[model samples]
Target chain A: MTYINSFRTGLKEGLPICMGYFSVSFAFGIFAVESGLTVWQTVLISLFNLTSAGQLAGVPIIASGGSFVELALSQLVINSRYSLMSVALGQKLSREVTLPEKLFIAYGNTDEIFAVSVSNEGEIGTRYMAGLILLPVLGWTGGTLAGAVAGNILPAIVASALGIAIYGMFIAIVVPIAKKEKATALCVATAILFSLAFKYVPFLSFVPSGFTIIISAVIASVIFAIAAPIKTDEEEQSNG
Target chain B: MDNGKFFIYLLVMAGVTYLVRMIPLTLIKEKIKNRFVLSFLHYIPYTVLSAMTVPACFYATGSTLSAIVGFVIAIVASFFERTLIQVAALSCAGVLVTELIMNYV
Candidate 1:
């Protein structure tokens, strides 16, 4: 495919992802403001961080007078999976993607975009990745703008109801695949159990939320990897 | 926090996050041949998402009952194979109705 064709393909795939992001970040926007951030502060967080959970988690801590160390540590832990994803996506890039281009593209490696790009048939080129990142970025910023700027205009009940939106996105992402694959289903259960245990248990509750996420994901992924190893990429594409 | 501190906070967050992404993409040029490792990474996304989601989901709304209703609605909506927006809209509606009912009940 020509660069334009690949870019167009990227936009096509990105449309659904963009829509998903708009709602999720819309939730993030409302929460950020509710948590004490100004509209500009909230929008800037979404603009630069471009992460749903990390920003959502960080803003609250900051609002409550948490230390800078807490903010940094939590962000690193919550988002560490991106490092692993970066390695995986690195292997899929075309040779034409230079070092700067690779680094540039890597900055926009959100979960939805990673899944879409990796599922493509061939090595991903710069143009395609650019297209993939573009729409989602716009939707993310746009949604945050709407939520932060016009959130007060929304009726109190509607704004409150929208709090469920991000969790809804998470459910949308996980449920279909879990329903199909027993192992992934098991993995989700394991992660949730681990998360709850850490949260409510006596001594374990002291574990920071960032570390808690890493431990749960790593521990559960390790368990399922041993029990039911997925040997092929074909199985993965189907899982998504 | 003042503007300077918040600025520093975001800058650090952005810097570290960019490194986490950039370093891996720049360094790992070859496909990892180890199936054990690949299998492990295979499960990371789902597990991470699941870990981030829960307990939080249960307490998201003003009322626990409304939040639970929304959670259930989101799960049920997912089984229908609807688009993301569809699922989100339905679950939000479910939460709205539940919250409104809670006002009276």
Candidate 2:
């Protein structure tokens, strides 16, 4: 019953997320196919990677015959947030959770899952977190496979247009929180400044997008922290 | 696509990705004490999203002029705290219109 209820909750939260993933992953599938990867290889990548930016970045690297070290470093930089997310969720989880369970749940950590997990309050057990993780993974992987199979059925223009959905989803997540929190607003502004600098500044222009995101995130976080510290009560609650 | 090499790569990628996520939680069992670190993690999402959206406003199309015009329109719309969907849609529309005009003129 506990697992069932958790699954149901996950499904409810994951449905809209799945809808968004369908369009983005569909595009990824087409891109992978066009990039000389077979359908099975594409499916495997989606099943394991489950990160749009990481996979998109890595695909080009692989195609260019980049070394494994480069691929790993790029993924590390882009998906480093999962480490932070795992720590945040670790606080919410029951202390008695086995190491194996933690290992299993960690596999499914992505931006969307992390967002939902962090936003959930109170005592979050391993089972519930697992449900949250599994449902989204399933949805994303399923979408990728379906898209790979349905390749080229949709017009190129339509696919390109729909590619914006993932960006829209990110905006949806950020804008609401930024409106409510001044710190969020400041962080966003700092990130934009740094991002533009990385892109336009001649010396920094050569930095990869993944590394740029990591650098911008670190810089923004430092600025925000100095400007506004979290209140004691909020800290206590988060720690608890 | 050789099935054997493909599956090997998939397994290696999965293993590496999972390990990255596991290391912090397994090693840093205690609460995060460094104020700077906490602050950094807290603001990462904001920075990432802003970085993505800002350039997206410009450079999405081939022309820099259209990007600037589209970005100005988006900034004005966003000042009202418009919904994301509305802001994105409007910005995309702005870009399309600007490009179309630029082409004909």
Candidate 3:
């Protein structure tokens, strides 16, 4: 396919992902404001971060005057998966994507975009990656702007209801995968158990919230990786 | 938050996030062949999200009962393979309706 055709195909594939991001980021906007961030601040976070969970996790740290170390550490732990994704996607890039182009593409290497790009039939070019990243960036930032503005105007009850929106999105992402894969289901269950222990158990409760997330996720993932090593071929087949 | 401090925070976040992505994409030319590592990476997102969701999501709304209602609604919607927006909108609606009912009672 020509570059334009590749780009157009990417745009087509990205439409649904863009639409999905809008609603989820809208909730992020509302939640951020409720947590004390101004509308512009919330919007800026989405613009720069382009990550749902990382932004959600970072807002609390920012609002509560948590240290920079805490904020940076939280983002690193929460978003570390992007490193793995970028490495995977990088392997599929066409030679046309030089270092500068890779830098540009890296900005949009989000979970859904990476998934869409990697699932393509052959080598992915720079134009296709650009087209794929564009709409979702717009949707994510635009949704945050709209939701942040609406957040200031919306009633308390409505805002409160919207609080669960991100978590709802999180559940949506995990449930289907968990249902299809036994290891994933057990992993999720184990992580939840760890999370609850952090919240309720006496000594663990003293652990900072960011570390709680890091520790719980890491411990659960390590255990499951050992107990149920996935067949690499099976993993690719499922992803594709 | 002071303007300067907030910007610093944003910079740090965007910086670390960008580097994590950029370094690997720009430099890595080979696929990682470690079985344990691949499986671990596969499980990370699910585990991180699940860890963040529980207990925290249960208290998301004003009332735990309403939050539970929303959580269950989201689970059901997604179980049927609903799209992300549909699941999110439904969960929000679920919480709103439950809370409104709670007020009446």
Provide TM-scores for the models.
0.88, 0.82, 0.82
lDDT values of the candidates?
0.82, 0.68, 0.83
Stretches off by above 4 angstroms in model 2 are A1-5, A234-240, B33-36, B56-105
Candidate 2 interface CA RMSD, Å: 3.6
* Model 2 per-residue lDDT tens digits across residues A1-240: 011226567667666666667666877887887777788788889888888777877777665556677777777877776776677666555666678877776777777666666566555566666667665676677767777788779655445444554565566666666778887887788888898899889999999877777788677777787888655436786898
Query: Model 3: per-residue lDDT, tens digit, A1-240?
Result: 222327888888777678778877877888888898888998999999998878988999898888999888888877887886787677668866788999999999987787667656657888888888999999999989989888678787887787787778778888998999988999989999999999999988998665677688888889988999878765677898
- Give the DockQ-based CAPRI class for model 2: acceptable
The candidate that wins on lDDT is 3
**Which candidate model has the greater DockQ, 2 or 3?**
3
Q: Can you list each candidate's DockQ?
A: 0.68, 0.37, 0.64
Better of 1 and 3 by lDDT: 3
Q: What is the DockQ of candidate 3?
A: 0.64
In model 2 chain B, where is the ten-residue run with the lowest total lDDT? Answer: B83-92
**What is the C-alpha local distance difference test score of candidate 2?**
0.68
Q: Look at candidate 1 and give me any clashing residue pairs.
A: none
* Cα error of candidate 3 at position A203, Å: 1.6
Could you give candidate 1's per-residue lDDT for residues B1-105 as a string of tens digits? 467777877787777677778888998877776777887877887787788778778877778888889889889998887776777788889999998887888
Model with the higher DockQ, candidate 1 or 3: 1
Model 1 bad stretches (over 4 Å): A1-5, A34-36, A61-67, A119-122, A233-240, B1-5
